[model samples]
Target: MEQTQGMADETRHPMTGNRLDAEAEASGPGFETHDYDVVVIGAGGAGLRAAIAAHDAGARVAIVCKSLLGKAHTVMAEGGAAAAMGNLWPDDNWKVHFRDTMRGGKMLNNWRMAQVHAQEAPDRVLELEEWGALFDRTPDGLISQRDFGGHRYARLAHVGDRTGLEMIRTLQQRAVALGIDVFMEFTVTELCKADDRIVGAVGYWRETGRFVVFNAPSVVLATGGIGRSFQVTSNSWEYTGDGHALAMRAGASLINMEFVQFHPTGMVWPMSVRGLLVTESVRGDGGILKNSDGERFMFNYIPDFFKAETADSVEEADGWYEDKKNNRRPPELLPRDEVARAINSEVKAGRGTEHGGVYLDIASRRDPEFIRRRLPSMYHQFKELAGVDITQEAMEIGPTCHYVMGGVEVDPDTQQSSVDGLYAAGEVSGGMHGSNRLGGNSLSDLLVFGRRAGECAAENAAKHSNERAAVPDSTATAAADAALAPFAEEGGENPYTIQKDLQDVMHRLVGIIRKREELVTSLTELEELKARAEHLSVEGNRQYNPGWHLAIDLANMLIVSECVATAALEREESRGGHTREDFPMASDEWAQINLVLTYDGESVGLARQPLPVMPDDLKELFD
Candidate 1:
């Protein structure tokens, strides 16, 4: 359904109207007034960059995040930022980088945005360098780069493997120094709009259960991805689709929610952290995938898509480590989806090791000193959690849910949603990665588009005048009442039980390998689970009620899942990360369109829209 663009009908009753007239009711309503030129929600890398940009433009900005300043999920990101920095391989350039990104994304990416991202990514990384990000420096003292999957050259600028930590911390400190007021531990539940223009956001202090409204002319959502909705994931708890859900509920069209990327290397054991990522850097540093029989099995799984570049023999694969041009399948690299499927096939074929995982042997493949030097965090995580030495024993590995390539629909140039005042960036704003996302592209996407969203939103906010359309007192009251509804339900349902069921439904049906029948079944179960969530009960006070908090997050997860499953069912072709057994090939028709999603409260459905065509000058470059 094409969402009609205007202020949605006031679903709540009008008898409780006149909240603005009642502003003098409780010592100025006792509701704190924080008027900012721009407010950025979700302080991950994207939010930080957005806040920084808005502040640099002389906007009074405040960043609201649900977690600590630097402890966001970005800190756990290993691997590196993909950029054509030319620190390691001088032959690399933005044109080749853009082409690689488009090809890796299966061409579903917005061509203009992909072109801009590829061009600007290098500069963003260099900006981080100036902000005191001490990336691993090359022998020439330039920021060092490393090899990652799907890139044609060694173009990922990294600092060991904890480059995300470096990036986030550097940005956080800079944001603080710039005097961007940060409201930590607050979760923005809704985007407030007046006369069809987003004017502010309403949230609550998790510590006090008190409602807070951030009335800003501009808002930027950099709230990251929705990986936590799955059973096995490589994201932090904070990644619960807040940005995606809020935007969708605010009437933004979502695109391509079906393409969730499953990373190829997560620890298979230890049920507690089953999906904790073992970075691709491990393979980049000379590790190889081995089956139970100790045979390097990746060579056997290379398909026609990668045959021109994949190595046919162990000697060639090994030789590629020193000289990349001579070898086919570089030992350090294979596209993420290909590698993940290969591992899954091996495990299913009875090639599994003792721990029900394939061997990721770097100990014998590379020198221990080099292994320890490149991947200190991996060494620590393994030693501390699994009690294994990566230098000696091969790390057991399998696939885990990592990222989603689908999100709120936006113009290829502006990053604006169908809604006029709304803009989305980072992982929450999709269409950049079609079926699969390359390892290093995510950080760069956040940086590139976060800046764009801020700029566009700021420009719109500057020209817009606040109409101050009356917000019914009943509306706010009902929202507050609904927020506290779970506490009112007396033992009708358990929050954890509903959440666990939702997770099981999503994981078992919409998992790494998917089919139409399973996806349909999953949707039915999701509907049932959502019904159960309505009456779910919770224990404890509102302050930090983990059970209640999860219940709220479950709604967002269900909505996101609905969009994903619906889009997956409509998209018959197997392209990039979205594979359907029934329609197992990419079609020419699918090549020209994208799956656009919107919800009408009664039901959510898919809409087909034309793909963004490349600019005239860039078309020849791509060809």
Candidate 2:
């Protein structure tokens, strides 16, 4: 299922001009336009899966992305997709997986979404295989399962350390095979609406200086996370909160935006490679965490919440690696929030490596050959980037900005936002993971909800089949004019300067450990940054101009950063990813509550809402 010439050609869309005829009579100068039942923004795992499902559901579909086909940020996912396939543990099932997810999320998760994700993930994982994905197999010939933090059993279906590469390649091949229209390297800047309903999305080509539109009844926002808001992050430039900002401007709400996950094991050496993800698979397959004095320190950091299931001594932790049934799991394998806090505490107390990091040592734990075969990417990444052989020496690792647990709030069943015709899924959509996400669950969550969003979006579009919503021609023009404002100003604040200042503010004030004073200061500084954002001036024209693109992205990041800080300040409890040093305990009062954010044109509004009740059957599984 290689890409055909039509798909491979980078910058050409014949259908773009077809809308010129339809809008010619309505407006004076018609911008390039294409009509579709559904237009999916951000061609990552979620977007590709959504497009495929929409096409199969008999809807005219299109896929638009900021990067070329198969180069999505999802390819950075090194571990596997989680699914209770029972490949290693015979007693494992969707019930157990669902319960584990809720526990890992600290009971703040949307129970129904967790149940749906756990139940449907195995089928979706197998579907990738049906579409010709080559997964590492178990000895009995099923897809191989491996250990990850929080899961009760070994349940991630992976292919060495490159599962995301194989998954994106497989889905990209399936998408091209189905002939789904793809607009590669296109940046969707705005989602236009007719009244309260979404009607179209407007964007510009990154390779050229032209604006394009995808006028549709429905638009699926599969655009990923807002990790770039922090100075140290694993997300790429494409993850500047485009989808989150667009949804907010369109009158959609975001849930639990305060909860941002900091992965415990990012590379912390050679300044150039700092914050690059050193996958948790390094510890998932029997790696150990050590302090400067060669002491296995994770054993001492296990909290009472997980103490029942975690080993408390070096001997127990070491033995648990080989005999999981007789012993408990190692403290190093705790949920991400717990482990990240432990690592942060260790480093702060001066037990860290020379690089302000802890040591992840696999050389002394696992065999060299086994390490090479299982962690080939980790081996190469360190060797090529930091000039260290991970097979022979321990690597410096620490917490870094990774994933956001908050995003566009949507219905768990339909994946549709409060605003009609606008759907969201994957990392851009919120409420599935609550405050913290388990490592492998993100991939499985993409498949389950991406497909659901596509089908529901298509169905929503079909309801309007007789009379399609029409966006005002002036809306796109205004958006385009606003985008070009940065280029119009001769000398103003540099966008890079504004962006760097914003990232520093977020990473310092609204970071992993927060306080009331820091959050207030962050909010005030964000306002000043917003004022400066108005005068964002880039030196070059739109053609291949990274500066102009970043100027547009800056506005989104500013809005998203405000939401995160505001929500973090409002939640006066220490739980999951929203840890506050001042209020350092989980509150039962806040357990049933979720914070929501929305913009009403003039100002942003925040509210508290009750969590949906878990069904009796699901509740029984937890009990």
Quality of model 2 by C-alpha lDDT: 0.87
124-190: candidate 2 lDDT, tens digit per residue: 9999999999999987899999999988899999999999999999999999999999888788878
RMSD of each: 6.8, 4.5
lDDT of 2 at 532: 86
The number of residue pairs in model 2 that clash at the backbone is: 0
Task: List per-prediction Cα lDDT, in the order shown.
Answer: 0.78, 0.87
lDDT tens digits by residue: candidate 1, 194-255: 77767777766565455566667678888888888888888889888888888887888788
Runs of candidate 1 exceeding 4 Å displacement: 1-31, 309-327, 465-474
Q: What TM-score fits each model? A: 0.92, 0.94
Clash tally, candidates in order: 3, 0
